[model samples]
Target chain A: MNALRNAALVAVVAVAIVLQAVVLRYVSVDGVVPNLALVLVVVVAVSRGSQFAAVFGFGAGLLLDLAPPADHVAGRWALALVVVGYLAGRVRQDARESPVASVLLVGAMSFVGTSVFALSGVLLQDGALPVDLTLRVLAISVLWDLMLAPFVVPPLLRLVDRLGSDEVAAARPVSLARTS
Target chain B: MRRRRFGQGPTHDGSRRVLGLLVLAALTVITLDARAGDGSPIDPARAAVGSLFGPVESTTAAVTRPFADAISSFRTNKSLRGDVATLAAENSRLRGEVSTDPLDRQRLAELDGLTRTAAETGYSLVGARVIAIGPVQSFTRSVTIDVGTSSGVTKNMTVLNNDGLVGRVVQATSSTATVLLIVDTESVVGARLGTNSEIGFLRGRGSIADSGRLDLELVDNAVVPSGGDVVVTWGSQNGVPYVAGIPIGRVESVVSSPRQSSRIAVIVPFVDFSALDVVGVVVPQGTTGDRPVISTPTGKADR
Candidate 1:
């Protein structure tokens, strides 16, 4: 199928956004909401490449940032998402044979992104996180991201393939195990 | 014969090294941030990102307002009329209970000042609507308001509603300003005991289960009067964003251990954050303005 033919991609992203704004806001299970958009971005980006993923990730994260009340300077979400999507794209490249590999990859990427957020937050604000609170939040975010990967990635992949979504669909994931 | 890795590619090792280094750097930050040090060049970056995203956030709120209203209609609609009725009933009951019983002159003066200040600043009734909250409550401590930099809102400006202080603005864009609520763990404000002149610092503790506990770092925890000690912003500092004496909450309970030099007192914020709709962004009127005074419903100054 030509990548540009499907309306499902936009639908999927819109669904993801709605879920994020409405559903997840109402139901926060242990303060951990599923990262549906991240799942989509990772799945598509891996099939595609960092360049496309980075741009889309920035835009998507910007949406999430806007969804929240603004109290700080902007662009943190953009930076976070670009890094997450691009990195996850690389991870997808590393895990072709095993679906479990993808889970682990997504989990690690999610943890990294969350950690970066927490770090930046603490630095910007004047406070510290207790061990238990930190552990709970991290555990929940990583698990949520990973759990969502299977659900969001396949649809995302199909969407990209249908929409001819930039180069992310045409390009394969890149492995980072070897040296330059 | 030498064999080459097919999909791994020539740059694979470089990517691995870079990824490893990035991971290590991230870990270092996590460690430092955990201990509460300025996490290495992180603040400027966060501020920068927050600044850039402000406009996009405001536009999104403007676009999505209708959808949000529909979604929250049930939650908000029923409560509004109910709240009005309940408040009217309570007001009638209170008026019957106490006409005037030789009120503490100081308390009377404070309440008079509060009313006067409310009338004078025109800030007493300035209203802002909550635009959006983060998808997850834990990771974020902010919400967008209709008011913005254009509305004379700026960073470090304190927000208030009927109950008292809400939170403070950390950044501002042209049409919208973001406010970080007082319950965010990172929030720090200068507060003190209302009963006595005992001063302390207020810190947010992120849990509703704790029912809005504010950590008190008191200079004189000993002098802090017991139960009836109403906590208010210690608005005495110049350039201090929060005005002195805006009511925060009363001291709920206090505990001290043998090893502890400072006692921890949990406070309940005056504002009911969950039901918040309209709020005032209290631009600290500094010493140039009249000081706000606080009074408690109960006359007790001691536990």
Candidate 2:
């Protein structure tokens, strides 16, 4: 069961990454696509604990870094997402309890994740990061992520709840009852 | 409380330790990749991932294209209808032109405008479609095309669409190649003014916003560039990156700076980097054997 759930988690993240890389570009506004992979990482963090979220974040970040058309350094996204996953997981209990808090957490983590990535770019002198352009990208990316959260988070949360271990299901009888 | 039951999952100390280890691992990978440059050990991993996801991206792009077209058509209904009429008329005109050029008729059947441009410019082209785009997580403007070394495409080859220059091939796998768009900040192409042939360097501003413009700075300060002056590639040695006489863009506006002696002009590139679909990679024609020798009428052929 654990192996099945882990495989499901990997499949979900992979699908999110592929969607973000391919399909999301068509719906982009001003070249800013929503960070769907980041949202998934945050959701995983909220449902699981920091340890699981960090591992998932690292793997997902590595995929984003290595994905084609990615010209930047390999570990920038990995670092940014690791931090996002850890921080998001710290508030797991509150986010799991309240839908509003979870949505807010997604928005906040989006900002942090983008900021971390941008800061790394600035430090590494990766590309042209003009103040105005960077700020515009940051603002628009956050808005896009927030807009995507309501539609994505709840369903993903329910799915993750279903994928939870038997021990977790036993511990959280309320969620199991709701699912039933 | 209920917290004790859930606390059995992972201890706080364990999670914190894991976070630190992962963070350290990421930083180490970043340093190694940054230091290694082109020969980074990560290249193999990147290529593997690209190959794995390449098919998925192409499939998704194909599947979603119609829905995308529908949404865009809804937004620009009137303009798109007019555009269709204009395109139909242009297609007929282009067909007429292609028929007149008997030698290029067969090859020019696909992407007529692009093939025509290549034929006129005396370049052999291999056509490819953009399979995927650079993720927004990174601010680089690049696209992965569906052609690579298998299609005779190599690094530093010029890519263009019907309008004009798109970019150059930066990386190529067997089945896919990555083209860095000319609008990327890292892109710099040598250019020549169509009017006076003033030498200059054009740099990308990294965004297609405000009409996908480029920055052109002349090597000489005396020549004043007026608005609407056409620009073409200056051509590199052996034409590895950009060939001579390919239309780049027109000077949209010039920005004069007192601190710098060189004059700067803003150019709007002909290629729409945003809606790129079919593009052609300019492949060099191979030499056919040895040069022909002419016989002289004089007694020993000038031996």
Candidate 3:
């Protein structure tokens, strides 16, 4: 049962990463696309414990980092998302986050996650990475991620809840009760 | 008051252990990939993963592209309709004057000018479709195009649409290439104003909202390009990066100070960088036939 659930999570993450790399790019505004993968990682982190979030984030991030058209050094996103997933997971699973609150959290996490990704590139002295560019990107990215949250997060949470009912119920009985 | 329970359940301790292991694994991967230098141990894994996902993405893109195109066309339809009306009116008026001597001379001169501009550039074009734009988090003003080495695309080639300059190729794989847009803060282009034929440097502000406008600076203190003056590339020696006579932008406003030797102007680029779709790359002239180069005429007074 655990193995099946884990496989489901991996499949979901894989599909999300592909959509992010390929599909969502078509709708970019001013070279800014919503960080769908980051939002998914955050949702998983907030609903599940840090442990599951961290592992899931690392896997998702690795796939993203390895994806084609990825210019930065490999594992940059993995490292960034791991930190994001862990931090998001630390916010007690049972605590109720209102819709606005969840959106705000996703927005903040997107900014922080992007910062970590850019900072890692900068630290590696990737000469192309500039501080001002990073800041500008962070600002626009946060808005894009926030805009996507209301649409993406609820559906994803519902799917996860439906697919892995036993674990989700064990993790947050209150959320299960509310949804049911 | 009810208390919040954190990390409860049967596998709590095991979860902590997994988290630690994951973190360590991520750190290790970052290190290994970074230090690998010219060759990466993980490139094959990445390539394999990319291959696995590529087909699905292509299929999805192929399936949904028409809807995306329809939406985009709908958004631009009104503006396009307005342009069509204006052009039709101008064409009718021009047709009425074809028999007049002065109008004939003026039209001939305009044709000559366009011919000279194209001849001066001496470029071979390769057309490509934009596949993906940069993610907002990367803050990189770039786009990936479907054509790459297979289509004779190489790094540093100038890219443009019908409107004007779009960007330059930064990286190229066998099947695709990434273009660094003119709006990227790091991009710098040598430009000449239409009014005085004065040359200057154009730099991007790198703002997502302000990307449509670039900063034109380094003009001689004595010559200030007026508002609406056209800007074009100065072209590099042998046209390695940018060819001469490609339209860039028009001056929006100018700023000057007596203390400084150079004047600054704001230019609104002709290309709509935000809405790029199909673009042409100015690749090297093929060896079979060399293009004839013509000297472009000097600047005319601003209208």
Candidate 4:
């Protein structure tokens, strides 16, 4: 059962990364690709807890870092997503189980995650991308992530709840029973 | 305040500890990867991931491409058809002019480049479909092409579309190649203005949010290119990365005050980067001992 769940998680991450790279890229608004992986981490964290979120974030980030044309110091994303996942998990523990609240949390976390990633790039001397450009991308990405959250996060939560992860079940009862 | 209390509770300490350890591990990986200086330790893992994921991405792209094309065609098909008809008429008229001026060296030189670049320069081009884009919010502009080392693609080879220079190949696995688009902030190309031939360098603005723009820096501050002047690649050592005479963009507007000692112009690139479908990788002809460098309009060797 554990092996099956792990395999399923890996499959989910792979599919999210692939869709982000292939489909979401072409459907970008002015070049800002919607970060499905960011939303996935946030959704999983909010659905589960810090332990599960942190572990999943690390796995997703490692896969993303290893992806070609990564163009930054490896593991910067892992560090950033670790913080994002933990923070979202904290929010999940405290906040009400409302879609609007979840959207707000996701948006806020997306901004923080993008900022941390950018900051790591700068500190690591990755490249000489201007500061203004980085901030603009962060802003657009936040808006895009929010716009996509309503569609992605709710459905994904529903799917995971149906898949019946014990960690997810103990953390929060399935509130998205009618999302699909 | 209630949330703050829960966050600080004894049970939460374990979560915090887990977070700390994860962050430490990530930082350690970053430090080791950076200091290692060659590449990451997980290169084999990376290659495996690429091999596995690349095909799935390509399949998805294939399935969605027709739908994307249909949507685009629905929006622009009428106007595009009209334009095509107009261009056809103009081409026939140009053909008459070319025949009449067959001996005109200037017209012939211009026509030579249009006929076949592979014939003109010894760089053979391998056509590839753009399968996926880099899925991050960072300044790295890269795309995955269906072709790879299996199709003779190599790292640092130039990629271009019909409009102009795209970028260079950064990584090529067996069945996939990753291209770093010229729009990447870190991308810099040696370029020159069309009208005055003033040499300069064109750098990518690096934001997909602000596409079709590059930062142009001139070597000579005294020479300012007029608005609408074309920018073309200035070529590099043996043109391994970038070849000569490929259109980069047009000057949209000039930045930097004339008196302040900086000449910077905003360039609108010719290629529609956001809608990239197919591209070509320029690989030098095998068995041909070094071809002569092509000359620019200003009578300077592009290399």
Higher-ranked by DockQ: 2 or 3: 2
Write the candidate numbers in order of decreasing DockQ: 4, 2, 3, 1
Relative to the real complex, the DockQ score for model 2 comes to: 0.41
TM-score of each: 0.64, 0.85, 0.70, 0.81
Give the per-residue lDDT of model 3 (tens digit) for A1-180.
878887898889878866665666645555567788898888887677677788889988998776655655678789889888877777634323456666777888898898888787677754244566667667877877887787677777767666664856576666645533
What is candidate 2's CA lDDT for residue B250? 93
Quality class of the docking in candidate 3, CAPRI style: acceptable
Full candidate order by TM-score, most accurate first = 2, 4, 3, 1
Model 4 regions lying over 4 Å from their true place: A127-132, A162-164, A167-180, B1-5, B8-11, B35-44, B74-115, B120-122, B195-197, B209-211, B257-260, B287-303
What is each predicted model's overall lDDT from 0 to 1? 0.56, 0.78, 0.69, 0.73
Residue-level lDDT tens digits of model 1 in B1-303: 334333344545655454445445444544443354433344454445445455544455556544333333433344432232343344445444542433335335534544454554333323466655554323555666766655557677777765677788775665566778777776878887776767877877764333547777787747545875788877745524676657788777776655877787878777766545556666422211121222233322111
Please identify model 2 stretches exceeding 4 Å from their true place.
A1-4, A173-180, B1-10, B77-110, B286-303
**lDDT by residue (tens digit), candidate 3, B1-303:** 566666566757877787778878987887887899656787677657655654455566667564444334343434532132343344444444434454346445544544444345555566566766666565456667776666677678888766778788866665667677887666789888876788989987664444467889955767868889999988898676777788998888887766875688989998777666667777664411122222223422111
True interface contacts reproduced by each model, as a fraction? 0.19, 0.61, 0.50, 0.59
Name the weakest run of 10 consecutive residues (lDDT summed) in model 1 chain B. B286-295
Candidate number with greatest TM-score: 2
Per-prediction DockQ, in order? 0.19, 0.41, 0.32, 0.41
